[model samples]
Target: MDGSDDKRLDDTLIALRRILRATELYERELAQAAGLTPAKLRVLQILSGRKEGNATPTAMANQMGVRQATVTALVDQLENRGMVRRERSSTDRRQTHVVIAPAGVEALRSAPSALQQHFVANYQKLEAWEQQMILSVLNRVALMLNAADIEAAPVLTIGDIRQDRGRG
Candidate 1:
């Protein structure tokens, strides 16, 4: 690429990285204020959003794009904290399902502000076409960055999976 093209790409990458970093910092602060690690808070967020009482280890692993062992460990930690509980599935005794406890629900509800609330509020104030254009550009940029890591799953947005599963 020419100098200008290279400079433009560099600038875009830097700006995107800054945005990601800011989001992470916000999440960390929010989780800390709620007495939870960022990872634990993420699990609580996922479980609280589910209308169904139990989530299978396989399902949660798939949702998080992590190995079953990692998901189990996360559940183990949360379970010990009384944020979640495990129950044997009625249909299949071998299947252990994870459910959010009332404490988990409260933690998720009371967790500190996320970037989504601020970003979405600002995004919603934009024109419909502008929102569409921004989404399109962002998705393209993400894909470009992930081109070398084709096996990686796309990042899951809040509510995306729930919507896909048709849960109310």
Candidate 2:
């Protein structure tokens, strides 16, 4: 590759690093501020938006594009910390819902807006052409890295973000 090609590659590497750094810093900030992992916070956000302030783990898993087992693990953490509790449904005794506790609501109020939420807010302000361009470029990059087929949710925490053990 020529000098200009090398420069472009370096620039692309820098941009990818910046995106990763931003996500890392955001996760740490959120953990320290609200003592919740991105996954847990996401679960709470989903529940808090519900009319009943609760949902089955399967429903949350579907919404998050993850497995029910993954959602169950997150719910288990929240329930252990008194942030949520499980209750059998009144109408469907066979169905159990994970209800956000008072503490969970308070955590949401205390935490910063999620990293992806901020990204979505800004992305929406871009022109249609700009949005399409970004999508095209990002898709190309993912394919270049052989990541196009990887499963991912809308959250932007990290590739494998660890739990925070409920600090707040």
Candidate 3:
């Protein structure tokens, strides 16, 4: 109940803005450096680290905690860029797999490290209760911003969310 509280609020807003600005900058940098969006880069990373450098779109969606359509869209983009290819599963003809191409591997190698990787590393080093508290505060802030209903994947890109075809 003091004027200092108003200053605190301004500081908080500034901090949030900085985070937003940093994310936007990172997105732009990644695109310029690797010629790929965050989502597409993530798709390639997933396939690259997986067995045989391939996975089904449904599986990728689950791993990324997004919708199949979003993953499909990312896959389509990567395929167009010659970063990945689609193949029918030999075991099940009905299932198609997205396989990372040589270009995908090169792109991954060329891309800068993701901002989320730094966040995740630091987050994991925090105490469990600290981590939980940070999560609680972030969730509360989302609710305060009326963003609790928003569908966001674990990725930290500022844009290109496209999490759901129908708000996934």
> Which candidate number has the best lDDT?
2
Over 31-146, each residue of candidate 2 has an lDDT whose tens digit, in order, gives 88898888889999999999978899999999999878888888888898899999999999999999999999999999998998988999999999999999999999999999
Off by over 4 Å in 1: 1-10, 116-168
Name model 3 segments beyond 4 Å from true. Answer: 163-168
Tens digits of per-residue lDDT, candidate 3, 41-105, equal 78888999997778999999999998898898888777877989999999999999999999999
Task: Between candidates 1 and 3, name the one with more favorable lDDT.
Answer: 3
* lDDT of each candidate versus the true structure: 0.69, 0.88, 0.85
Tens-place lDDT digits, model 1, residues 1-168: 999999998998899778878755765566566656545666777777778866887887787776677678778877877999999999999998899999888877777765666777898999999999998987787688775444332232321222212211
Per-residue lDDT, model 2, residue 90, is 99
Top-TM-score structure, candidate number: 3
Q: Where is model 1 poorest over a 10-residue stretch in terms of lDDT? A: 159-168
Error of model 3, residue 166, in angstroms: 22
What's the best-to-worst order under lDDT? Answer: 2, 3, 1
Better of 1 and 2 by TM-score: 2
